[model samples]
Target: MNSLTIALDVMGGDKGPHITINAAILAINKEPRLHLFLCGDKSIITKYLLEHHIREHPQLTIIPTTETVAMDEKPSSALRNKRDSSMRKALDLVEQGKAQACVSAGNTGALFAMAYCVLKTLPGVERPALISALPTHKENKNVFMLDLGANVFCEANILYQFGLMGSVIAEQVDGITKPRVALLNMGEEDIKGSDHIKLAATKLSANKYINYVGFIEGNDIFTNKTDVIVCDGFVGNVALKTCEGVAQLVYRKLDRFLSEHFFARIIGKMLAPALKKLFKSMNPDQYNGASLIGLRGIVVKSHGNASAKAFEAAIFEAIKEVEQQVPEKITIALEQGLIEETHTE
Candidate 1:
């Protein structure tokens, strides 16, 4: 594989540089071909590096910055005033071709704003969307969902574009051929959703490149019925949070039940490994990285409260995206979809 270089916003997340610096070291140790440009305060980053005994590692480069984007910073304020912040500088590296991708666990709005302003959207993409993979019911399978709180609402054409982008990620990143794509809606019936959704469905169905699977309700998200599910940020974000909430609830309830009875406790002990494995597959931390798709350059958003292991997963996600040439593929896919639509007309 070719060597990959990625820029890291070391001081961008809730945990600050400590978590990010540790993740950077973990990534460097795991992937020999990966190099990182750590953008943050020189003193803090250096201290962490020295403690790890990799201050002079060949795969790491420190890009000093004096400013940091706070977790509560307004998107507009960060964009206008944080030109020299770690988040901004990391994005600049991608814009200048110094890095293949940028990864940050920063304020989502601020990251989105800075990345949009710096990298711009790919040609034919009006708005970029957030895409992430969620575990499916089928063992070892996952489905890609998009527009996870990037834009509250979307026009018909924008939603259609999101479906196309999601399809590209599913196909290219997951190696799924002609991945089935669907829209998240209240019901599966053609007449169930708002006008924009129906119109978006029509557009997706017309595009030969996308295997449009019609509408799917939220309950079917993890059923592996479709490879990609598309929706506006508002709906997608709510669905994602609900899934997280339910997962936690189920785990806690199961634990409580097993502890209430001595016999159940014995059974739980015997079933411990299997239950642990099942829960691990459903752990959100393992899927911490969410890709901001439809942009000219690769940008991954790590969970704001991610641990070192979770942040390392985000780094690996960036590496996979870079190796797959996701942005370039999405561009070509959109162009092809447009041509196919024109001919259908």
Candidate 2:
């Protein structure tokens, strides 16, 4: 049987090792051919293993690390000061080729910093960006949004590159061949936003390599008008978080309205199954992870508040990314100059 071992950081996150350990166990049970290298305090992991009665799985192994990178701590400090931190150790396993991928629900900034420092970026790529899949109304259709929180400030050329890379990922993962790419702007016209938007649109439209769809407003996101949406990290991150907040508000409102009265409660009971299925399809946790694109290896960033189910989904995402050799494909795209660098001639 082909074996794929993943390095999971157990000591990073708000819940410490609880959610991390449980997620690992859940992933192992879901995929028998999968093995996990748990990096954290050995004693803590061992205790959880014993408590959960998961002591004797040949597929599971634990690697001890003395320190941990905190959520608020800077990545540089964590890397330089905490040599034995679980997050750093996990990346080390990936660097050594001992693991196929690494998953951490821990510090986001630290993970990005560590990944760039260790794995490095592919040739022709400026900086790595975070790409996430957001569900849309169209059946089996999802939009790929990038620079979710990687680089807060990006140049026009960087946004153009993000379009190319985001398009590649959308085609590969979402099966959207000939994906339509768009720049996130306040207006759809050619003349919109600041000098940056105009510059990016001009450059993107001139690129024969990308199917640039001009500009798309934020409201157009749910219309499935475009397959890939590219923007700076600041705007992308705000949009992503706004969507999440809206989803939560809707869920809460629905729950309160449904349980408030006897008639509504009866109606809710009748529609519970269908409503649950619909909500599950739209839940952020169901799509709780983002891929750190442009890196040399496959690295996924899961939600900080991810549950076992969400973490399990992240593992499956990692498996698929590795199986498809996404990094190699990206390298090929970069080498062929499919992504161009803009110059002010």
Highest-scoring model, TM-score: 1
The residue ranges of model 2 lying beyond 4 angstroms of the native Cα positions read: 273-286, 338-345
Residue pair clashes in candidate 1: none
Residue 127 miss distance in model 1 (angstroms): 0.7
How does model 1 fare in lDDT? 0.91
Query: lDDT of all predictions, in order shown?
Result: 0.91, 0.83
Candidate 2 on 223-323: residue-level lDDT in tens? 89999999998998889888877777887898899999899999989888977666655544335678888888888887887777777778788888888
TM for candidate 2 is 0.93
Sliding window of 10 residues with minimal summed lDDT for model 1: 279-288
> TM-score, each model?
0.96, 0.93
Q: What tens digits encode model 1's per-residue C-alpha lDDT throughout 143-226?
A: 999899888899999999999999999999989999999999999999999999999999999888789999999999999999
Best by lDDT: 1
lDDT of 2 at 279: 61
Local error of candidate 2 at 79, Å?
A: 3.0
